[model samples]
Target: MEVSSQHLLSNEYTEVYRRLPLKLQLAYGVGHVLNDVCASMWFTYLLVFFHLVLQFNNWQAGFMLLVGQVADAVSTPFVGFHSDQSDNFWLCRYGRRKTWHLIGTVCVLVTFPFIFSPCIGCSGSHQWAQIFYYCVFISIFQFGWASVQISHLSLIPELTPNEHDRTKLTAIRYCFTVVSNLLVYVITWGILHISSGEESKIGPGDAPKFQHVVWTGLSLGILCSVIFHVFVKEEGALGSSDVRGTSLRTPIADILRSVEVYQVAVVYMSTRLFVNLSQVFIPLYLHETLDMAASALALIPLIMFIGSFVTSMTIEKLNRCFGRRLSYILGVLMGLAACIWIKWGSGDQFKSSQIHIIAVLIGAGGSITLVTSLGITADLIGDKTSSGAFVYGIMSFTDKLANGIAVVIIQDLHKDPSNTGYYRDVLTYVCGGSALLGALAVISFLKKVRGDPLGYENVPNYNSINSDVLPVATEDIQPSLIS
Candidate 1:
């Protein structure tokens, strides 16, 4: 009996490694942590920077951000396409993914500081130059981020073929992301709370506090870039090229042809845009309507991500118990509930305890969606990530475009925060409706892609991958603008 058990254990270990190695999992996760921290710090503060500092109108700032996002969206597909087709490029010792990774790092390093301190705005010109400079710098930042993002995410399916392994990586990566975001919130709170003794709140002139994030983001971003280069290993080749879809226009056409890709895209676009709207509005809502302290406003993200990190470990189990689609539906509902409360229940008062509960609900729900969306994307592509650079790039494209639309809608609908109540209501209604629509989109995806082999129970073994590949689907219409 003992010999038999030991043999079974060895076999299990072998199968697990064949799926995804533990070291690679940790390395991928580290890169994800770095990714979120660098990205979130500025995005979280973007509206605040414009509203309180440069003093751009809500619409103006939103439009500025929109331009950058649109530019990034345009570049994502090309970036993905290039990376997918690439091998070791001219003189770069690294693989295809690594080259873009390095390029993105330089872009961020060169442009991040300039974004915070735009030349025109700091030069006392607050008109078109400010707009132009902001748009230009932000575009650079978005493109650089996309360059790193698409390549980095493409490594996931390349690391493993197992659906279960992908889910585990997703959960682990999401956990790291939550922890890092939590740290960002806490650090932001510390900076804001350590007031200059004039006022207990954060303002544009609060340079001393805001500058901390600049230095921290720059330093940590540099360190993480190094870590990404050192740790992330690209498989150099795909296990197979046969995939689902009907388009034969190009390899990118083939990448876009997968049935699961469309399904993933729909769900991702809806929920991701919803999440962005919520994140963009929280500070505005709390600061404008509730008149909450900046430190307290910062605490909400900390609380939300804390709730997410603690429970993120359970995402796989939830997916197991409920199936990925239904588990995602549950998360969407949680987000909807929180959003509705924000719309109606969150009265104009400084209620920390109640707000914390709201944050918990939003955080946990978001965490679930975050993990599943990423896992499903990897699962959809299977082991094709090595050759399907545009797969992840397409996913990035879908995500950024949705967010762009969301920001545009928010910016357009919201004239100003001077009418705080009306603006708050507009934001809540829009964002809440978005959550509802996102849930509906999830449901639609579930109904249409009913028999997809997304769950672990239905997962195919490595050997099950035969020569059959899905042909790319023809683009009948523009992508669904559900968000």
Candidate 2:
């Protein structure tokens, strides 16, 4: 009887951790399309909508973004914590992560359109009322966004244990993200071009263009998510055990105490600050500093996404060849060069062609940095699937909070929206400075990981992994989880 039981257990273990099928990977990759599309609008267009179409000043626009970020930051841990415990919830029988994903998806689809739509029952004279109205919806939208983001990201660690597979998954997921961003920019460019006038500045008349963009994004996101839920399936809650024969659920206290955790977290956070802040300011730079037509807003970003799409497609091979840290530094340097060009080479003349090249650099740099940072994060998580959501939650907390505070500070620097010079300087410094800092953080992270530069030594052997279901107590998980 004992021999038979061991044989059955061994078979189960092999089945759970086996290489993921191509279809499963593709499904998992598409799962984030909802968040990606909405986020493209949120980061790229939120400020533009508030400041331009709704007539909020720069401060007010930045404040709205801050509100959403705070909400997202606050909600992330709760959703992550609860998601890790989804096995206990009856409603999560379909899947703990998917249940939260469904809830978040519903919240986003319902509230997101209203965010870009007219502030019903409030006119331009009632500025505070409109602000309050937006605050409510933005808060809800942000919370939902966090839920989707945390759950989806946490799924990466849960789905596979192979480092190469994890890298592939992360790379594939990013490709879909790039595609989502491309779709949104295309939709926005087409709508703005067809609907709006020849004027460079976006005005109240362009409100409907934004509405069309959000709805189209929401609709496409819905379809992708449906395919995700249908094709992707979660195994049993305890998950495949590590080769060390330990439980998948490492204690939260253990995770928090690891130096490696903080290392990857910093890299992840700095990368996000670089990507998001640059995205927020890019449109404003084009419209205000370059004095390009409104179409430039979508066209420039469209070009950038094209560059990112190409990078995402090829990054897996680059990562295999160059290693994570070197690849990340390469991306950072590219972004820094773009920032330098923006600050000096562009000059006062509206040289549209040169700016498009700069856009490509930004996009390519952003793709490599984001993918490698996330790949490093998955390496950090390894087989600790239970706390994966919490780890991601904490990382996102720092990213969103820092980004919010940064935006508020940057926007506060120039109270007047028409003051393009200060804003221009701000963009160059924030984006360039962040990329440099992120590169430094990556270098620092390697030193902290002891002899394991790639941090792959922490991962257990996949072939011998067992799923015996031994959940460790906090006191039992030693600090050596990192070393």
User: How many pairs in model 2 have backbone atoms within 3 A of each other, for residues 3 or more apart or on separate chains, i.e. clashes?
Assistant: 0
The Cα error of candidate 1 at residue 262, in Å, is 3.0
Clashing pairs in 2: none
Among all candidates shown, the one with the greatest lDDT: 2
382 in model 1: Cα distance from truth in Å? 2.1
Mind giving the per-residue lDDT tens digits that candidate 2 earns over 263-353? 7778888899988988888998888887778988998999999999999888876776667878899999989989888888555443647
Q: Give stretches of model 1 more than 4 Å off.
A: 1-19, 91-93, 118-122, 196-199, 236-250, 255-260, 346-350, 416-418, 447-456, 459-483
lDDT of 1: 0.66
The digit string of per-residue lDDT tens for model 1 on 239-315 reads 32323322212344555565667767776776677666667777777777777777876788788888889879999
- Among all windows of 10 consecutive residues in model 1, the one with the lowest summed lDDT is 470-479
Query: How many collisions per candidate?
Result: 13, 0
Stretches off by above 4 angstroms in model 2 are 1-17, 197-199, 236-240, 244-246, 347-350, 416-418, 450-483
The TM-score measured for candidate 1 stands at 0.84
